[model samples]
Target: MARKAYSRRARVTGTLMLLVALGAAGCTGDPAAEDSPDAKPAGGEATTARAEPGKYQTLPQPCRAVETGTLDAMLPGLAQLDQEQRQKAYEGTSSVTYDSDRRTGCRWKVDSADAGHLLRIDFERVVSYSASVSDDARAQAVYGDRMKEAELPLPSDPREEQPERRADDSAKADRDEARATAPADDEAGQGASPETSEKPGKGKEKEAGKSEEPADETVDPSAPAEGLEPRLLRELADDAFIDDQLTTSSSGSGQRTVTVVFRTSNVIVTVEYEVQPKQVAEVPDSASMQEKARELAGLLAERLSDV
Candidate 1:
């Protein structure tokens, strides 16, 4: 009985030893590789991950963003400047900023016989600290707030109207047009009144200034040309809007400021063009001012693409 017991004990010990050895071998792995940055789960998901950074890491120098040739169109005073003054004008004054990487700006101002022009360009680089949100997303949020502040006209949605109602409205408009084309009985017997008729070149006079009393068909005396009013833009950048405001002082001097703001990726750009006419009666042309600002904004966007 003692010998049988000893043999059983020996068999149990050997089996236990074999199991421990196998377990130790299975647990064996390279400590260095396991801790390495490149080493990751073969089948399991990652514990944590960093998010993508913004596309723009640094901002461009604002002073040199606009070229001299472009400045000439935007700043008409450049045409009358002397050699030294022109060079100085091209070298715009840098705006005061503590951080160039995050924000930078340049300002140019010149006085001409017709008007005083001031151009300001600003660039902002947005960054996201969150490991989940991207830089572009942060920039988009900032731009949304800015758009809200601008209060530009939102595109009208035709689909929002009932289809049947829209059809009725279109029919009514057609009918109204037909009636307007038909001359009144008094006009048929005599002639159309000057106020009711619009000549070919008459549209040009209404552009910069208008003394005519506001009528149903006449454009506002203060507002810029018909299409150049403060509105959202579709062609300048990924997102952009132009704001034109004409301010008249007690002296009757008028200053029209055209501001163009746009965003590309993680960067936001702003172009402000102000024209204060020398004559109080001279209303700065909104179309021309907006055109110059839009052009400068486009050029800056292209310049940023290269960066």
Candidate 2:
């Protein structure tokens, strides 16, 4: 009997210990269970956020970017210019870029009996250090700033209409008086109801009112002045504008400069072309210079996109 009781006691103790072990296991939770969202990942690895890389990793050699034929076409006076000056101009001067990948430029200038012409091409590959901001977006912001600085006029929307205001009080009063006298005249007319008489008379009066009202000389409030004209461009990069500046030198010769700025992806290209006619008081054609600059810009944009 004593041996059996001892055995029973041992069995009871084992049951209690087993229950305590299960309770401890339940309290601690499962070690091999699926991970909760709040917990760290399995391997303790973290993702490092980074901004997108610029489109062009390297820039074309600025001096060689524009071809010889293009230079000749852009500067008509190149052959007629002094030999020493023409040689110097043909070998364009390159900009000193610390990070050639980020920015570069080339410049050429020559003077002749026909005209003095200057051409400058600049390339800037935008880069953003912030992980949340992309290089292209940074470039877009810079472009917006350039547009604002140039004071480029936005294209007018045809849907937008402004109500004309009456500048003459006497004219408005006259129209009001005519409208008031119409009903009495219709009432006085035999067999002429107010509706019939007023309809035809009111039509005539409205026509007269329209004719008498002074035409408003509306002007685009956002347009830049005549001297500093900035116009939008198409068929180039994403967004672009051209600025035309005409300045007269002390010698009385006039110089017309056209600056074409365009953005493609993360790159911004600026082309500055100017023509100073040889004859005093003569001015370069803004349209002609703009076309030449745009042609050069398109070429640069094409090369940058290929890279």
The candidate that achieves the highest TM-score relative to the unseen native structure: 1
For candidate 1, report its TM-score: 0.69
Which runs of model 1 end up more than 4 angstroms from their true locations?
1-40, 43-50, 159-219
CA lDDT scores, all candidates in order: 0.86, 0.80
Q: Model 1: per-residue lDDT, tens digit, 200-299? A: 5566788745666566586556777768878878887778888888897777778988898899999999999999998867788888788788888889
Poorest 10 consecutive residues by lDDT, candidate 1: 185-194
Cα distance off (Å), candidate 1, residue 303: 0.5
Clashing pairs in 1: none
List TM-score per model, in order: 0.69, 0.65
**lDDT of each residue in 1-307, candidate 2, tens digit only:** 9999999999999999999999987889655554655556759865666778767667788898998889998877787867787777788999888988789999988777778888999988888888899988999999999889987667667456343433365579998998787644434566656555555477788999999999988874223356436787877889888988778777667777789999988888899998879897676776667778888888888887777
